[model samples]
Target: MQETQDPVITSVKPKSRFPKSVPYIIGNEAAERFSFYGMRSVLTLFLVNQFFNPTDNPALTDQANAHANKLHHLFVMVAYALPFVGGMIADWFTGKYKLILYVSIIYCIGHVMLATFDGGLSGFELGLLVVAIGAGGIKSCVSANVGDQFDATNQDLLSKVYGWFYFSINAGSMISTVAIPWTYEHFGPKWAFGIPGILMALATIIFFSGRKKYVKVPPQGVNRNNLVFITWYALTHGSQRKKGEAFLDVAKQNFDPERVEGVKAVYRVMMVFFFALAFWAVWDQCLSEWTLYAEKMDRVVNVGFAKFTIYPGQLSTFNTIFLLMFIPLFNYVIYPWFDKRGIKTTPLRRLGTGLVLTALSFVIIGVIHTSLDHGGSPSIWWQVLAFLVLSAAEVLVSITGLEYAYTHSPKSMKSTMTGIWFLVVSFGNLITAVVNGLIEGGGWWATALKGANYEWFFVGFILVFVVIFFIVSPRMKERNYITDPVIDGEVAANTNSL
Candidate 1:
């Protein structure tokens, strides 16, 4: 058999040097997020106003809210679920760059359909299906691609790079989310939808321009046993697995040393991923219930000098604003402070804190709703407090999750692990979907949420989930592998020794 040639290593690059493609990737992410959040921020209100048919009292049109709510969650589910296929296909068949490029074109078509058919249900549904194809397909690959650009050499930048990468995302989202609804209100849905489509095109163009500079990882197809199969192998075959055995420890008797280490790391990450479900479930309320809450509240803005009325949907942009501020503070100030104080401040630990903050945000909203139930009209700034808390949690759980997904997974399973990470979010949206269903049906919980007692749902149930995950988070292990892998020869030598 012929030997595969070694990849040529060039001279040492300076630490200050960032990847040539990084600016483009960051630009693409920002624009893509703008495309997504712009439409999403207004979707519920839009559906209730134009698309969904109402059967409730002509005055209280919440009769059709159930349909709109169901469809909204279904859209979220489809968007997150397809990543399973996209990530798996990328791992074995298409690789990240090609798959993203192909799906992005479809994404643009979805947006065009929205621009063309905002008044019709069928066209919107079709457009959503197309957008889901592109959005879900790209989710797993784009973040993983960011990690691909780094190696042992420039590993120092991963944390900050991810921070800024996330910042760019929310920056675009903040701008478009604040602007799109106004566009929809005045310029019309055609322009509102069309603007996002244009941004998606720009995102695609920027990404394509950087293709030559991207660190393209070759796809390892179905023939390889990825982390999922390895986990299965450990669970099914290893009876002598001991306590504190990093789940991959079960593989010591069956696999090589390198494979064993990889599985152990993957296992630890999966454990954290499971607990993360609560955070996402609670966090995504910004898309649904928060908008609903905003509609019921006052939105007259009087900022010191200038005053203008704003749409309730524009309130969602607060998250983007908070995220931009918090990510840097966490990256430069918070995490560093922890490390300086002899605390490891691991990803799981951060995730646990994020959940607490999310629960707190809900508590604030619940109280505000209670006040509204009393017929006292408070300023919209109350919701701003909630968004600030939630966005802080986003910086904690989300950006940390990005770093953890890349550094913790085995090289071969990185893309798949990324997909599974988002699958956790789908599960979160599923939680909201179930709640929406329960609310649609007449129930004690629904009655409480409906008639001004909504405070208990956040302060009671969601907070309980936060406490549960906090207890479990400490049990999940953290393997901080910031540096890249050793040479293949070194890995093979270690395997031989094992």
Candidate 2:
């Protein structure tokens, strides 16, 4: 990796230069990733056979791909939805760390139930919901907590920390996705899932152990105040305002003049959050529908030492593997080269590229599906390439977005904004559910799969979103909120504390 000076890098220190907090966060993230990917990697396969409708027939399976797709879509949809609720819970009652710890326990419970009992449709669905609730709570809090470790004083290291943080997530995911699926395939479902449950338990324990080492930023009610101020500002500045503005009459009592700039700043961040809905709608499919598609492909690998069998759901591991490899290369080498040439590598640029790359990934899958439709047996390398491309895009968008959103939002509203980001994924999964339903109906599914047009359907769907996001990108603010300090009677020196 090159050491060329980038404005982004100069503005934020190398995460390597930071204190011990980096290791703590990385450790927590690794364990969390192991728990998440271990379960998620096998969710589609488990739902179709082990949990929902236990089966043994090979050629014509008891539960078809369509049913698995629908179940996968709904599971992902709820997982994304619960984050909003979890974020709110963190804000109003429990703090972020507390919420993460508590929900993770519930998450472990869900895995235990899946591993131990006869989880039929209702039982399995309940387990998925529990997992979602736990995941949502943790997802809402954890990334921002990583940011909490650094302030403006040491914020120069933020990009590096974020890079390393993402690396840890992939490391954990790669192991679980590959190993857990293999275990399930051969050793049986109990060991596959039970192992993840143990990992989750360990993660929760690790988090509690490091409670004192973490940054304890509580959720402040900044949004509620911002809304009141906006209402007042609208009423006072209106050309059609009466002698006594009715909206301002109600709003003025709650508005504090001392926090006016802070209120405006929070609103500005909200502006960017509104645009990400479409990006996530397309991004979430990698887990939900894509997994099922990969499952259908033939993935028998014959190595010298042993014969390796690949599961469709386990293909997600490739994304994580590539993510681990690419983040450092891009952050240290690729972005720096671009930066030397005066190209902007800010969060917005990364995010825009992510949108495009996601579209491209679907395009690749669509092409494969098209060839396979003509009775072609596509090589596994195609899927591998797709994961590689998608991982590059993941680094550009997903990891950067996590770092960006956490740093940019009002300190008090961090969890809420994280929840919003997850909500965008929820919306995406919901859209996927609708799309899946459409494909299942009106002769479309048969035509696409039989004619190898499934690739076209997937490609066409993503292209539609790619165009939508392109139009939306310009409206997004390129300048970061992290650079702008919200003054609220605290000394400027304390800005980093936020």
Candidate 3:
């Protein structure tokens, strides 16, 4: 039997300061998020109010809610699904740096397309296609690039760095989510869409500023075939002929140790992703289902300066606003405080807590829905409470997820596994799309949920899976992966699951 050893990561000297590239990357992310969420804040409203007029077709008017929601989810589903192709290209062909640069330009063009042909269905569809391609293509690389900035010596700082990363994202998101809605209402759709395009241009420029400062991982080249060959060789060699052998045990017995280790890492990542997949279903609702619910409520605010009425969609900003506050609190005070007490707040534990909080947010939503159904106009303050809970859930699941995917992924497949992580989110949206299709088709679910209305959406059902995954998550093998120097002529990935 061959006994090839896996390369062990060597500890390097930790830099006294964070990488010079980090601020630039964080700046780029903030601006890019502003561009992305700014457009997203008003998309459904544009489609419903302008793209298709209710006066022309009564059926379109009646089903406008479902149609707009479905379209929004479909856009998200396609955007996330495209990352698999993007991840493969980044990992095996063009490296992440170049791929991100190229795709981001396309993203800017998409914003221009949306701005130019405001409210046209055909143009909207085309723009969404191009934007999805560009956004999904770059998403995998960007997240992994954050981790590439650190190595074994300072890997402990990754979680905190990701928190700040997410903080930047929400900083941009909070602003755009609030400002864009007002822009759409006052200035117009063209201006609103154009603003995001301008931000995208700035984002590209900011990213390029970090070019020399970043540690760029070169393309590893394609070796998916090696995986297939190893699997075949193991099965044929009778390596599984032992008591209590599990599936893939033959590969472990016959393949190199590095290959077996890579396989194990991949397996652990898969387990975490399943739970993450469920978490996304609830988290993403802040954009889709929750917005629809918001439109039904009253929106009056007194900032002590003046009394102002706002759009319901603008309420989405609350999630980001709270994130801006909470991320720091947890990173500096809360998490550190717990560490002093020897309470281990591992990623898995945080994930489980996030799940429980997510379910609680839905319960709050359900209560609000009941009031709305009974013709009691609940104040917007009630939503603040819900957003606090939900945003806490997000801090746990989404932010931790970014760090988790990069750290847990096999060295060779960093970008590829990150892409797969996004695909899990895609699957969540697909599930929502399917269920909505059934409800739209006027099936038994539609009849059953008629009175329940918006409250009938799957909070408890998703929570059930979250609990199941949480129970299984402690069993997930946790490991710390740092940026390692490439070994000559050795494949970065050792697993057979390319």
Candidate 3, 1-498: lDDT as tens digits: 999999998987656557778998899899999988888888877777776543545455425655666677777888899888776788789988999999999999998999988857899778977777877878877877898899776677788788789778878988898889899889999998999999989999999989999989998897642344455655686644567854455665556656655655665677777887777765666787666667667778898989988676688888777877888787788878988998867777777888888888888888887887688888877877899998898888888887777777666556556667788888888777666666666758666655345454667676777768756665555555564433552324322110
Candidate 2 lDDT score relative to the true structure: 0.67
lDDT of 1 by residue, 1-498 (tens): 999999998986675667888998999999999998888877777777776543334334433555567667777888898888888788789898999999999999999998888888999989978887888989878887898898887789888788789778778888998899888888867888889999999999999999999999888877445666666778886677887765566766766666666666666677768767777776766776677667768888998999987777788888777776787798899999999998867776787788778778888888877777687776789999999998998888887887788876667556666777778888877877777677666657456557444445645666676677766655544545555445652221111000
Identify the runs in model 3 with alpha carbons over 4 angstroms from their true place: 1-24, 52-62, 146-167, 208-217, 225-244, 252-256, 331-346, 402-416, 470-498
lDDT per residue for candidate 2 within 221-261, as digits (tens), equals 53555444456665666665457744343343445533443
Task: List the candidate numbers ranked by TM-score, top first.
Answer: 1, 3, 2
Candidate 2, residue 268: lDDT: 50
What clash count goes with each model?
A: 0, 6, 0
Backbone-clash count (model 1)? 0
The CA lDDT at 422 in model 1 is 76
Clashing pairs in 1: none
State how far residue 229 of model 2 sits from its true place (Å): 9.8
